[model samples]
Target: MTISDILRDSDYSLDLLEKHIDDLTIFQKEQKSGLTPPYTVCKVRKKEIKLTPEEVVRQLYLIKLHKEYGYPYERMQLEFAVHFGREVKRADIVIMDKIQPTVPYIIIEVKKPKLKDGKDQLKSYCNSTGATMAIWTNGKEIVYYHRKDPNYFEPIPNIPSQNQSLKDILTERVSIDDLIKIDILKTQRRSLKNIILDMEDEVLANAGVDVFEEVFKLVFIKLFDELQNTRKLSTHLEFRNYGESDSELKVKIEEIFAKAKKQWGGIFNDDEKIRLTPSHLSVCVSSLQDVKLFNSNLDVIDDAFEYLVNKTSKGEKGQYFTPRYVIDMCVKMLNPQEEETMIDTASGSCGFPIHTVFEVWRKIYKDLGIEESHLFTAEKKHERALEYVREKVFGIDFDDKSVRVSRMLNIIAGDGHTNVLNLNSLDFSRWEETTKDESWQDIYFDGWRRLKKLRSDKNSDKSYEFDIVMANPPFAGDIKESRILHQYELGKNASGKFQTKVGRDILFIERNLEMLKSGGRMAVVLPQGRFNNSSDKYIRDFIATKCRILAVVGLHGNVFKPHTGTKTSVLFVQKWDEKLCPKKDDYPIFFATMQKSSKDNSGDKIYVKNSDGSNRLDSHDHLIVEHDLYNHDGITQDGIAEAFLEFAKKEGLSFASGKCESPFDEAKYKALLDGLEVIEINFSEVLIDKNIRFEAEFYNSKIGLSDNFLYGDDIIDFV
Candidate 1:
């Protein structure tokens, strides 16, 4: 049987054991009776063993120890016995000391696949035999630890080779180049989310402190430590633990955190301090030291922050963070230019604005002809891109924790200045009262001043003139307070009398439209009911009056799973203007429905795979999530966004060039043009149509096509 067959229905993976397959396969013996599975000879014990799932991991780890780490067979022992007061248990694998063959130097455990179980067993073995190091793996993720004492176990990047000492591994000088090569996230196939979960099981669950605050502090300090060497490549990183006492390491980390707060202001209070104990801090730092936070995208940090925020009150308000892939699709469909100003009205973690920054940076690099490399995210070479982020991009949110996370991410993208503010977008009347506080002025005054310059009217906060707006506002509850509801036209009934309550997302639809200029465009995520339900026709009517609908892409039901399953679709529109978007009574709208969810039923991401059934990595050495919304930098197939781009060009949209081309014969084209007449049927006139529905599925079903059908120019012709 193949290795994959042997490891099926188990928690083990063959990712780390690929190299040793040929070495072990030569000794495989097939059963003559054909009634039992195959077996293999162990390299260390030189005896035949049944190739069960655990045995496969044990045998492959032995080969890695000998080949990669330079350990010899003479120093390694399998099932070594350990004695406790008249009780004895056998260890999985142990590397004996150099001078004394009976003493264990490094204890490796492969029996338990889960980290917590394996770690607990390793601790017992180390405490009994007085071993200084321990190792744990299940053929997917590997962690090395140094047993500092009976009470503490600190994680190390890697174990020393045969010629090296423990001090050699701890005291090695590391630069950013070293970090890029050895980032644990890539090498061990571990994500930041999994690392945080490990930390919680190790210490944070009972640390008597707020888990979010402590983790945020560590991440803030670690980011600062990496930024110090971004431009200067040879500088040594200061975020590691190098054989120092717990108290000394705490002092050093605290000093670095202080510097981070000074560098990125408004994230924390001036008097704030790390509350994790010295021992707890040491364990946490060692776990995070080997990870590279900056990549071509900040998805590593974004995933971790989403988990932390969701553990608190973020879910109760129906404010799940937007997935990065969705943000990318919106940005690509909009085709935001370098000169355009963008904003996210209900910015949760600022995904739209930050991705906009990346999109603009891609354009700037093309204009300057600067070829991007793997260091694109970490390097600060383009001054124009930084200038655009500082001056043009903006985000606003009411949640304080989310605002801090948004500001921190924006600061990293902009190199210092951030236009992200903590404010309520719907309640514009209270902004003046809130901005008067001296403490608020200290942090938000500069951004507030810049925002006032974009207002269409200086005397009121009701309207602004931004080029683009994108948002996924909260949709769970209703606004019962008449004070907030009175400001929105959607708050009124058919007779123009204000209603007592309205859905929160309904008001944001009006609020987002008001923030755009005459020719500006926007994309907003709304519930499917808003487009199909007969009771919500007034909401659709209000939208059709102000702008020309561009496109509507229906999302899968699993897009926001493990939280809520409200089916949603993105509504794209552009305000009518004399020059950019002339008023049109009859226009064809592009429609599409997504097939691939990009996530499984459990809300975990499903990565693209190669023909050999191995996970696929992009050009940046990151796993690619399988989806159909858009092509991911050429890694995925061209999808709906690409189809819409072609349609926009054919329709002569303002952002796209060229006019519609005909496929008929030259003589037939003349006859068709002569017979055509200009037709004007206002969209509002369709309010009385009994079968009216704005959803893409409702339209696509009428054409006898499935959601997964490939769309191109011919599909637009059919429309």
Candidate 2:
């Protein structure tokens, strides 16, 4: 039977994808087959692939290639094999030249996102087969590239159609305007990151300017060019030839750079020239000019920025970008709504703040009556949606380079910059010079004025303005400089004597709390030592005395990856308000411990795959990579976020199940059982209490696994 026919029970989850692939269609009829067990035929090789979820994705991509791109059947081969270093591996699909059957034209990866080296994987396949193009897709996202040379893969906005030649694609007219029209459906179809990395290897090494500064300037010019050409798709950033001379392209790029600087003054100097030689500049412009940077999902931009910054400032400065997955979990659980102010004190690349802007934008869009289906991709909504970002969110950082990067990211998300200041948030006294400088008046003064209203007092000690705050401060450093140390209450003895030293995060805990007004909620990442160390009893006491602790979730040691192995937890707190805090005698708080850390001990990310060893994909036809304390792809019952939500309902915890003592539907979900005797002994708490007496806490924690529970259809509905 076909998968649709076998799915009569409706027991299986149809979509593990958090995002959708709206651009492509997969016909149910095309997916069904007449084999004995019902397998689908590959359009390329005419071979039967078993009708599993992963195979279904492969078939759809193949159809897109044939119908949309007009790839000839004779040119294609399925299960194409290629050598990877010493080992030989078979790829999903490979397209060959009809004239030269031995020569591979394109290599396609239809495997779910689990294929770690998407670019490198395709590169090796090309090295073996001599394919000129590589495409990777999990159905949610697709990456297209031209294997420019053995060492580089250039990002092409779109691949050529059946009739178009490789030369035509390389030399086609490309405009900044074509990139501004946001196509929401193409969320996963982007990648110039590897291409930029390739550029570094190819020409940037010998470029006269700093690699980061030059590339950043080029990107800035490209973005501004698009902004100026908004909604006008016919305008082009094209050059006459791919093999242009250095001097000619230099003049043109310099003109663009000068204009971009004039338009956006703060980032670049007016006299800043295109440090790249004309030939190199022409190649970069041709490679990047066609792609829409703003339309790409924030993840793509984030990845590129991470690569650039890691090569330069972040590593030496003790700054690391917070993984987007962790940021998503915190945002989801907290659920920031429209009009509520949010800030990130540490704000490394401003991940917390930028995402907050997105969440708020989403809420405000729904409030203004935009359909959820069209929200992300709709160009009409971009300006309307970004207003909350400019008005409500804020950030501060100690590093100037980090501040510049943070501002640029915010500028993209907001479509303009807001209040991302270059200052030491902990050293509030030094903040005056930063805020008062004449050079920073336009960028700083207005936002500073607005932020100043948030302060509880004139002195920087009490700025209780923001309603919500989220931060992952630098953990590897301490405040040895007693000058900055004296600003915090943590820096003093009981008699008010200055302490010699203190943990930087300890001071930040106090600083972040001060930034919040009464009843404002905040989430911060702190070391495990704060929670368990007897030596730090005062820190815990300080937290208890200042705020009502909401929830504490232990994070995997690998969350910060290749950076630090320190065990950390996210502590959610709401500052004391007269109603929710001061008057409360006692309240039960939610407690959780993360079970499945989707990462290995070595800090390498682990992905969810199938029993057959193929990577598992979500409903979006994209690979569902799990990186948090839980898995959220809907393929596993391992989500700690979902578990906590369920627990909140049961325990009548605040913010989850309406009010503190509300009733819970304990039997929300029930596991399916096959033909077996059903005792239903777990139905009663009294019967469970008797068995619980003999069970150790650790033993009970594994209840859903082996002994005392059936092998299949284990504990369901929290019974």
Best-matching candidate per TM-score:
1
Please, what are the lDDT tens digits per residue for candidate 2 over residues 436-507? 788877656756776777778867635767888999887766788988777777777545667898888888
For residue 474, give model 2's deviation from the true position in Å. 0.6
Q: Write the residue-wise lDDT of candidate 1 on 128-218 in tens digits.
A: 9999999998887888899988877788999998888999998898888899888988888788988898888777888899999999999
Error of 1 at 460 (Å): 1.3
Instruction: Output the worst ten-in-a-row residue range by lDDT, candidate 2.
Output: 669-678
Q: Would you give me the overall lDDT of model 1?
A: 0.82
Q: Estimate each model's TM-score.
A: 0.91, 0.69
Backbone clashes per model, in order?
A: 0, 8
Clashing pairs in 2: 16-619, 17-619, 113-623, 138-621, 139-621, 140-621, 140-622, 141-188
Q: Judged by lDDT, which candidate is best?
A: 1
Instruction: Supply candidate 2's per-residue lDDT for 293.
Output: 56
lDDT of 2: 0.62
